[model samples]
Target chain A: MADVAPNKLRLLKGAVQDNVDLVRGIRTPGLGRRKLLESPPPDPVQRKRIRRLWLWSPLSLVVIAYLLLPSPVVSLRQTAPIKTFEAEIKQTPATAEVKVPETEPQAPASEPHALDRGVIPLAIKKIVIDAGHGGKQPGAISESGVSEKEITLDIALRLRRLLGKTPFEVIMTRQGDQTISLDKRVAFANTNKADLFVSIHVNWTEPREIRPLETYFVGPSDDPVTIKLASMENQESGYSLSEYRRVLEKIYIDTRRDESRSLAKNIQAELYHSLKTINPELDDRGVKMAPFLVLVGTEMPAILVEVSTLSNEEEVQLLTNPDYREKIALALVRGIRSYASNHNGVDRKGS
Target chain B: MEETNETFCVGIDLGTSRSSISASNGERHVIDSYVGWPVDMVARKVIKKTVLVGREALDNRLMLDLRRPLERGLIKEGAKKDEDAVQEILRHLISLIGLKQKSKNRAKLRAVVGVPAEAFRNSKQRLRSALEGVADSVMLVSEPFAVAYGLEALLHALIIDIGAGTADFCVMQGRYPTEEDQRTLPNAGDSIDEQLLKLMREHHPEAQTSIHMIREWKEKWSFVGEPKKPVVVTVPVKGKATDFDITKEMGEACESILPPVCETMLDLLARVEPEYQENVRNNIILAGGTSLITGLSDAVQKALADLGGGRATVVKDPVFAGSDGGLALARDASSSDWEKLSL
Candidate 1:
């Protein structure tokens, strides 16, 4: 009994410590060892301060030393040419191995380098709109034989026209009904330096009355439904298995995930609220995370919006209406404009 | 040790199928973990209440938006109403044990709650937020660990907690269990009920049955081995009641969980030090509501034949084992430690 008392006391002490750790929000040991839970880099404002200090400290020291000296002196030497990111990209081959940028060390954000993606935020200027299904790959055909490709293209064009009147520059993955590989779409966005990427898609589900308006950002998902949708969207992606695995590995550390999620939430809320006032049957599926290939490969905030469900008979009829399509386009523009206003100080009216 | 009048301590087992609370004031109560809200104006008028809980909630489910509120021993995510339901269930349990939160003269409540072995940090944090309003101080521990502590099996014992939603296995090694020492499997009483319902439907296509009825039948006759008498149940078949002998179906459903349970048990046993493996196996304890199933201990003991041989014993009070253990911990913890656990 004496021995039992000590053992019980020790166990109780351990339990108490566990509870203390929980209250302090310290993660349980051995859990979340993955890079996804790795501490994110400092916020943009702090990083900017550090970068300014680093860039000016040595110059300030040199100037002070010169002023203190009785005699003026000058030193000059040949300096090596600094390598620009554009040079590196130009030198690398198209089939070169992909590597995750070393963003962990808080590398000095002194230059406007593309690889230093998350450290600084430039104003939102260029936007890319990707219509999900195109050409021979018709996504989610309705019972009445209306292809998802036709619907997405129509909505994408409408959105492009709506945004054209604003101050932002707009780029589309395809201007017409044309087959474009997922790899080319990602490459085009990166090459053109788009600030935000939006991929338009229509969903399909059983019990046709359930029209779910959902938006997704790239992250690991355990839900079987989300996994199935991701797998279906990833099909026919030109990337090899090894490349896909590499993309998945970086999904957690993608500094853009939070920004993408914020963008998704804005779009989802706007879509649901605007459509609900007009059509009360739509279900707000809420913003979720799924590893869609397009969302995973982008360098900027990216989202995949399932505008509406084609599986619903009523939604199918609504999609066929140009006025209803115009409403969806206007709602999407409002969401994008809101996200931009929050992120890059873009004007709400896109002035 | 410390002043007792100002503090009230209780241990709660917030389970998927049922919840139990054991208080220091010599009160113990158990209730089905069900919460519901009146679904319509007519339902509100008929039920004469804004919310219902436990047996009342289950009884008036047809007129209410009934919610189980828990999935696999954790609060189901993505539903705002489910969180409300969980809060109401906790409130109901506390009220049943004579701890009214609204009473100004009531003592400051300190609680120890038990959850599944592998519950994530996010789930634990969510539970803590949910419990903030119900108790002055709260502590969360794995359910199997609580059961082991309650049974005084702190040294060399393996506890298998077979609850409705999850089967938790923990190996006690004289110190607090770690992630490596615990495993949770989503195969237990609820899975047995589902399997039994599927089998009965396949065997008697015309018979009408519901999951609730199947659950009641399982609680009465669940066993993993051969039955002494034929198991039978009466159900409506084309508007007439008929007796369906479900002995084989019940046996199949009850035995279906054995493979996964045995596999996990052996796996955890393999993880223990070879020197203490025999002692741990010799002192195996089966706990939770599903542990009361007839012949389950014998079946588990038979599975231990591969590791030489072992004994498996069921707790005398399976339903209250977790909550009782929690209560014991609450009482034994020093006042300073309790202060550390305060919300």
Candidate 2:
């Protein structure tokens, strides 16, 4: 071994005759047996390691898949853009066992970080603002003859101005008094990869005295009251009530329902707190579950806010005031910030 | 009006703590009145059902919206999102009685559901709505009255039926015990359980104790006058199971209701016809699941001794007393006794 040349390396360090024999590490002898037959074969331990790896590789692949892939590929692909709740969650330090992939779209760096202590910037980019009941569809009319569409649009624009100060990308379903189809509104949000979906609407019931500030997340309407609200919002939509359960079933796998509910609760709380002074009688109905077509069709954390019933005189007067509308807008901005504050970039690949 | 095989009569003690239903078909069931609905689709799939009743409901409550629809022995009034749960419990009990739909004439169900003493008319109306589709004809009767009816102590016995919810006291005066003859207090087994739960939680903040655990502890180690022995049990604190001594707290919670019951018992005795007051005081019947608490009868009798001589007696079957009485009433009730549905 010491006599070997500097540039030379060999499996067997004895005198070699032909170049082919040296390269192959085998030499022919006149004993009628192979020349290197007497030499040591490959070490049993090293050979066994290679053999074991080959034997266990397939099983390891199955185990890895079982541990990581919690959902189907088709569902992920369909909801890839807007459904980032689980994907974002996977990025947390608690989930060290699963590794998130890098190729997924990242949150914008300019956006305000979540308030969650030491959380990474949640990639909240585009947000869709849907002012309910536009054009021919006059949402709800107040006792004083104020249209719900006007109130919603006014508040939505004000919200746009408030959010404009931040790095977020806000998209309005309709910039003016125009009718955009339900499919088109949700499609616009999905197309833009909106992180959050907020649809603004006013509530209505018989006798016009019901005054409540409630937020709704997409679910099977739990009661007749919820069904009535869903029906009122889902009037023009082509979908039927029969399909509501299916929509809820699909949402359960998407992980958006939980986020949507949290968003609703946050927004509902802020709205009640801000407006409680303007209308002392304003009732905080809290978060509710309903199958509104606008929410069910969306693939994002969506909530429909029944800001205040137009039937109540106090609330109707409150909605009519520009200062009150601005307060409502500011409250909504605060809620969105709170909900998105803890959202951070998480690697959701194989989740 | 005569006894007929076409109709099935069921007597039910629809209590907040426990519910019991006894049918004419000789089937009987008593279950913890806990109902829960799965929280989401994943839970529904994993649980393999939408609604769960009784102990199963409590065991899988994490993934459910657990609804205890009754409070103070009446269907919880003003409690939102409880209608479905109330109906589910009613339907489950009726099913346990085997209301075979395929049978001829559909076996018209005429149920007499025993309720808390002096239950609100609104509560009975709510209960009536809940029982609409389940039973063709139904009647709501005071719980203690039902117990008195079954025991045939309808003459002059004072019934103090202590249950998980309200403590019902009724004066059986030969005729039906009217609302004026009964008193319902919102203090009983459940209230004690709650008090104990609060004490346990406060005493050992790190202990993982729920209402169920507190209830179990109360049932096994409850004593009024004295502990007699150390009332200690192992409870999971933080993560490790550790021995916990709750003798003082358990004793206090169990004894909290005694004063009210004693006062009510004295008041009812005073109100009784002066002639029958002696008999009523002597024959005071302490009947109900909560009456099983050791020394409770003696505690009552001791308290009652202040207002002349009195003796408190325990029932042979506290659990079935109310239902058995309700069954007796249902079988004896005339056609006019049942509430006729408009349909």
Candidate 3:
């Protein structure tokens, strides 16, 4: 009946602004401190640029590599940061258009944001395998009590074992049943200097029978289903407004698009071909593109493959089998091997 | 010559199992958060309606495509029908309070809705989208904060709102509770029902039970610690109605929430400033339907003994506490402020 207190008014204002910010898809101001804690150190942007520069120019790579090397006594402090090679692009328009036929790989593109093609293609040495959901975030559950978190973790661990036999260095975003925020996972992958990221997830579809083996690369998607899937997967992303906006901006222009797409295609193909032997009902949903938070944040080529659908009771039954999980892991290895062999000419036996 | 729209304010607690609304015109109502449509021509003909909501939807669930849209106090993600069901639930609640959205609408509607503490920004945005055509303007706040506001416990009060979907805890430091000042646990009424059903099956293998029946049993007989009397319910046993004494099962199911709830309560209490910690501990308020469980407040108070003794007050009317608090907030906000919050 009377005026609210001054402190009440201030609280009301804060509440109103927080609500408005959520409606506008802007991160709440109060969460800024927590976001800072989750975020990586400030040097990543500079370090990423430097890594890209080294990839683009061999001469700069030699000089910067020497400077970056640990000295015996005197630790060299980086005072003046070197500018990214994008500055050189402005002066050399002819060189931008010419695709290197000998060393460069993947599709040819003149776009400045495209993956650097001047450097010799290298075999993916470090692969960061992220298990989709864990801990409190039980992504999807079936009536039989099987959860997506457990299934993904099992498959991820299996994949790690299979990859252990190969030359590829495997890094798991989560090695156990623990809740890791998407931002933290991204920071882990980036910090570890992973050359590729493969996130494993299980799908849950309606009507229970539509089991699809799908893989996704980082790119904008117009499909409603894909958009919904991305939205669901992006829960508890823990990225602030500025970081989210930056990721959104890169969705279309990401330099890893071509490599990720190629990887997705290979994986999807292998998964469908290998999995259909065990279950003929499995459909190849094809390599589609959506801006999954994991795929968006990783600097290297990344793909999220829905290895199989847990929604289907029969598929879930198969997924529970150790041999079936082994087959899924093998299919993934084959996909990676095929992609590696094609992209960088790294043979499965040689690597 | 212009027609001016009359303004009306509303407060809504869009909960997981139940939703309550309080309007400026002294109309208050609560409904089960359910929405459904007739599954077939026969169902439509028999029900005499295209859509059913709340109790009606629950009663005629076999004949309807029933949906309890809110999962853990937020819209079920990636489900289009569930999203529509949430909208329908809101629309039904608004209509129950006698505000028509389309009848040459003369009244400007401003609503304050309560969501779970620590709800994601995306979930809040989804809730906002669900309220699009229902209200002219809307403000969303945490359910416990709304409860605290309505109680006028402005400073140094802890509100633990245990709803069907989530047990939301908020420590009121005078200002609107931030992410740090609040916590949400999934251990609430629904979890109790689940545990009860599981235990019932384990205890009486012959007794057939469903979630709906378990929910009803929990609402009637749920309690923590010692029960005043044995809880006996008549359930179907091998096609015969038989009475089963589930006192032990009921106690186990209800008390399952004690450890997490007590731990989180103490955790949040410890986070409060040292000088104000005593006041906060003494002013602990419990709201929401689950708080109505017998001896819950006493059990929580017992847990507080470890923290040098404290007080726990159960809200007299847990059902409308959030809605009333939201209504209080809606009434307090000036017209100018509401204008900026247009949906």
**Best model per DockQ:** 1
What digit string (tens of lDDT, one per residue) describes model 2 on residues A1-351? Answer: 344222221211111111122123232221111122112333898457435544543443333233233445324434443234335434543223111123321222222222332333346777889888765676787644567877887788778767876888887886545545564576677877888999999888656676877898864432566666666676545332333334433432444666687788779878888888867777777777666767877888899998878777677766655557878999999899877764542312212
Residues B1-343 of candidate 3: C-alpha lDDT, one tens digit per residue: 0113488888899999999999988899999999999999999999999889999999999999999999888887667999999999988988999887788845988899999986655567778888998898899999999999899888999999999999999999877776668878888999899999899889898999999999998999988888999999999877899999999999999999999899889988887999999999899999999999999989999999988999999998999999999988888887777777898
Q: After superposition, how far is residue A225 of candidate 3 from its true place, in Å?
A: 26
lDDT tens readout by residue for model 3, A74-147: 13332111112222322443323221122323322344456543354466899999999876787887665567
Error of model 1, residue B6, in angstroms? 0.8
lDDT of 2 by residue, B1-343 (tens): 2237767788899888789998887888888888998999999999999799988898899999998988777665445567777788888888888887545678678777888775533456678778878887766667887788778886788999999988999897765454346777767898899888888878778889978888988888899997789899898877798998888999989998888788778877877889888899899998888999999999988987877888888999898888887776666654543422211
Candidate 1, residue A178: lDDT: 54
lDDT of 3 at B310: 94
Clashes of each: 0, 2, 0
Residues forming the 10-long window of minimal summed lDDT in candidate 1 chain B: B1-10
DockQ, per model, reads: 0.20, 0.00, 0.15
Q: Please tell me which model should have the higher TM-score, number 1 or number 2.
A: 1
The segments of candidate 3 whose C-alpha lies over 4 angstroms from its true place after superposition are: A28-351, B1-5
lDDT, ranked from best to worst = 3, 1, 2
Chain B TM for prediction 2: 0.95
Best by TM-score: 3
Model 2 chain B: worst 10 consecutive residues (lDDT sum): B334-343
Give the range where candidate 2 chain A is weakest over 10 consecutive residues by summed lDDT: A9-18
What's the i-RMS for candidate 1 in angstroms? 14.2
